[model samples]
Target: MIPIHENLKGKVAVITGGSGVLCSQMAIELARQGANIAILNRDAKKGRDVIERIQTSGGTGISVKADVLDKSSMEKAREEILETFGQVDFLINGAGGNHPDAVTNTETYQDEATGKSFFHLDENGFSKVFATNFTGSFISSQVFGKDLLQAKAPSILNISSMSAYVPMTKVPAYSAAKSSINNFTMWMAVHFAETGLRVNAIAPGFFLTTQNRNLLVNDDGSYTVRSNKIINGTPMKRFGKPEDLLGTMLWLLDASYSGFVTGITVPVDGGFMAYSGV
Candidate 1:
């Protein structure tokens, strides 16, 4: 069972990409804590499904059609959320993913590699990945900043990745974008420090999500080479479950638990960040 934070009761939480594997779990858990959830996704149906689950569990929430990359879209979402919830207490920037075109088929550079290489990476695809991951978060924050600042105890939680710390192979665009998220989190935290708007991030380790499932799993249902390497590197010797992120997320979002904490990215990696591959 997930722990409940009393401070979250009756507050409002806005989660971007709330229909995704990880963020969906966060939306449900926050709802369980009595927070009114606003789930934003480009796919309205998927967002509504999450809301249905929340409602079935006796929680309050709404699904909003939004594109994190578009400021106007986020603005509309924010307006709807405010209309329903009256205020915004938390913002979770959870909308980010990698495109196949932005990735290199080979781990390292190769002069004669037949597959797509770094030199052949599609500029449009790379730009889309970077914009979706980094620019989306930036836009969402801007659209919601005023409402968050007005709250008595507001916070912003960004979803980062383990790649942000150590750039992973084959996905340079994803790595660079996540790294920017870490820096942006710190920058926003300091910018709003005196305003009581805390900004933090959760850098999740290797979790199997739609975005990385292809890279981590094979058609035969066995772990891919990359997945095995990840497990070996993780001190816990396993890929993280979605629930693994809940505790840290709650701790960071709850002012009673982490009021003084800001401008930091907490890694929920099951010791992945600590292991040195000795």
Candidate 2:
């Protein structure tokens, strides 16, 4: 809304999965920093809403319907961004999710003798989870990174998860995919270091959102066993808010602040990764 050129105004930022909860917040915050946010998401209406909010706040943004798994779709979106802003300065590869199929029925449910829960972990589901989260982010990096070479300074931020550090049980696919993202962030950072692009990642702890609301709280506003365990394990003793990540996001995106930083996967958890749960 206010004049932005002082800090990060006039920069172009692309956020995949921008329609989702966390990325949507980043889009808004980045816009507030004077960036032209290009929101790319498969969901048309949700992306539109994020754009609308950015516009309402007097920040600039545009919504692009895209599938992170599809290269052509990402290139088209990149073309659209070039048409709108001429260059991309920041890229947030935020498209990812867990599939019900990739998770076992319970954390310690290894009763293959009964074969009850093992049957639930379908191969098709595992494929979907891997495709969407891991493969999609990888493809998006390639597509948008083409422009980074020409820009003065460009940045790539990937979304990882707490699962990457410690497997929480059940969601083996999610853990694997996030771990890949973590590793890829470092690899890409080095691979592109000479090209003026800084690649980094954020591994968030449990954040209550529409995606994981059922797992955290009940309809009556009570915490579940899973949620309690998470709280107890975390030294901070609670789940994270989406806004809790904005500080880290801002620090990483601004070149003036973290110019020398790259290949780092900063954990924005509530000390969850640090605590041994003693």
Candidate 3:
């Protein structure tokens, strides 16, 4: 069972990309803590499915159709959330993914490579991936800043990645974007230091989610080459589970647990960050 944080009770949390594998788990846990959850996703139906899960668990929630890349859409989502929950106490910037065109087929550049390589990566695709991960967080934070500041102890938790610390192979755009997120998290935390609005981030290690399953797993359900590398590099010898992030998440969101913690990215990587191949 997910541990309940009493301080989170009655709080209102707005989670972008709530329908995603990781964020959906976050939404459910937050709701279980008695927070009113507002799930924002481009697909309203998918968002509603998460809400249904929350409701089934006897938690309060609503799903809103919102595009993280669009300010007007986020503003509309905010309005809907306010109408239903009255205020926003937490904002989880969780909408981020890489485009296939932005990823290189090979880990390094090759002079005679036939497949998509670093030199052949589409500029538009790179821009889209960067904007979706970094710009989306910026836009959502700005839209919800005022409401968050009004709350007694507001917090903004961003989803970062291991790639932010060490650039991963074959996904230059994704690594760059997540690196930007780490810097942005520190900047925002300092910017809001005096406002009682703490900002932090959780940098998850390799997790086999729908978005990354193809890269990590083969068609027959065997680990891919890249997946083997990740596991071998990690001291735990495995990928992280969705539930692995909840403790750090709850600690960061509940002021009582992390009131003074800000401008930091906690890695729940099962010792991946600490391990070094001998």
Off by over 4 Å in 3: none
lDDT of 2 at 209: 75
Output the TM-score of candidate 2. Answer: 0.94
Error of 1 at 65 (Å): 0.4
Go through the candidates in order and give each one's C-alpha lDDT.
0.95, 0.86, 0.95
Cα-lDDT of candidate 2:
0.86
Collision pairs in model 3: none
Predicted candidate 2 versus true structure: per-residue lDDT over 26-55, tens digit per residue:
899888888899999888789999999999
TM-score: the better of candidates 2 and 3: 3
Q: Between 1 and 2, whose lDDT is larger?
A: 1
Q: To one decimal, what is the Cα RMSD in angstroms of model 1 from the true structure?
A: 0.7
Return the clash pairs for model 2, or none: none
- lDDT digits (tens) for residues 1-278 of candidate 1: 87678899999999999999999999999999999999999999999999999999999999999999878888998889988989999999999999988999999998987999998899999999999999999999999999998998899999999999999999999999999999999999999999999999999999999989999999999999999999999999999998999999999999999999999999999899999999
* Candidate 2 residue runs with Cα over 4 Å from true position: 1-5, 110-116
Cα RMSD to native, each candidate? 0.7, 2.2, 0.7
